[model samples]
Target: MSKASRYEWRDQQASLQERMKGFMENPGTEQLQAVLTEMHAYAAAAQDGSIDIPERFIAFS
Candidate 1:
């Protein structure tokens, strides 16, 4: 990629890392639980064929 593009990508990555670090330092437990619950629902849907995961996708974490 061009120099300008690389710099922009690096800036975005750095910003995301900082945000994640803050979240790790102070997690919102309720929010995290809600998201995990939603993800489980999606996994269930995929398993039951109500929705489909991409072929060759590995097991969900």
Candidate 2:
């Protein structure tokens, strides 16, 4: 990947980590696991250039 793309990916990964942190702090194990599973799917889609950021942003918000 280009340097900028790599940086953007890193930012997205950090955002995912922050989201996971919030979920972990307030949710039960099963909920947190579910979030993690969704996160993995998101990451995979992102890596494949298939992530719909606008849609995901709305869903996440």
Candidate 3:
């Protein structure tokens, strides 16, 4: 890349790194459900409005 472009990217690199660090520290709610389907955890419940997970699993996540 050109020098000017490289310098611009360098500035963004720190911001990207900090965002990644925050993600690594805590995955949050997104980690719990990977997708939107009956096969996945929440999706199955959404279809029939029935709760599926056990109380212990809630705490574990």
What local distance difference test score does each model get? 0.54, 0.67, 0.43
Local lDDT at 22 for model 2? 75
Judged by lDDT, which candidate is best? Answer: 2
Ranking of predictions according to TM-score? 2, 1, 3
How big is the positional error of residue 18 in model 2, measured in Å on the Cα after superposition?
0.4
Worst 10 residues of 1 by lDDT: 52-61
Per-residue C-alpha lDDT of model 3 across residues 1-61, encoded as one tens digit per residue:
4556444444544444555555567776553232222134334443554433222322232
Per-residue accuracy of model 1 over 1-61 as CA lDDT, tens digit each = 4556455544544454555565567789754565556556655755775543333424354
Stretches > 4 Å off in candidate 1 = 29-61
Q: RMSD of each candidate? A: 11.3, 9.3, 18.3
Question: Which candidate, 1 or 2, would have the higher lDDT against the true structure?
Answer: 2
lDDT of 3 at 12: 44
Positional deviation of residue 41's Cα in model 2 after best superposition, in angstroms = 7.8
Query: Which stretches of candidate 2 lie above 4 Å from their native place?
Result: 28-61
Task: Kindly provide the TM-score of model 1 when superposed on the true structure, using C-alpha atoms.
Answer: 0.46
User: After superposing candidate 3, which stretches have Cα over 4 Å from the reference?
Assistant: 29-61
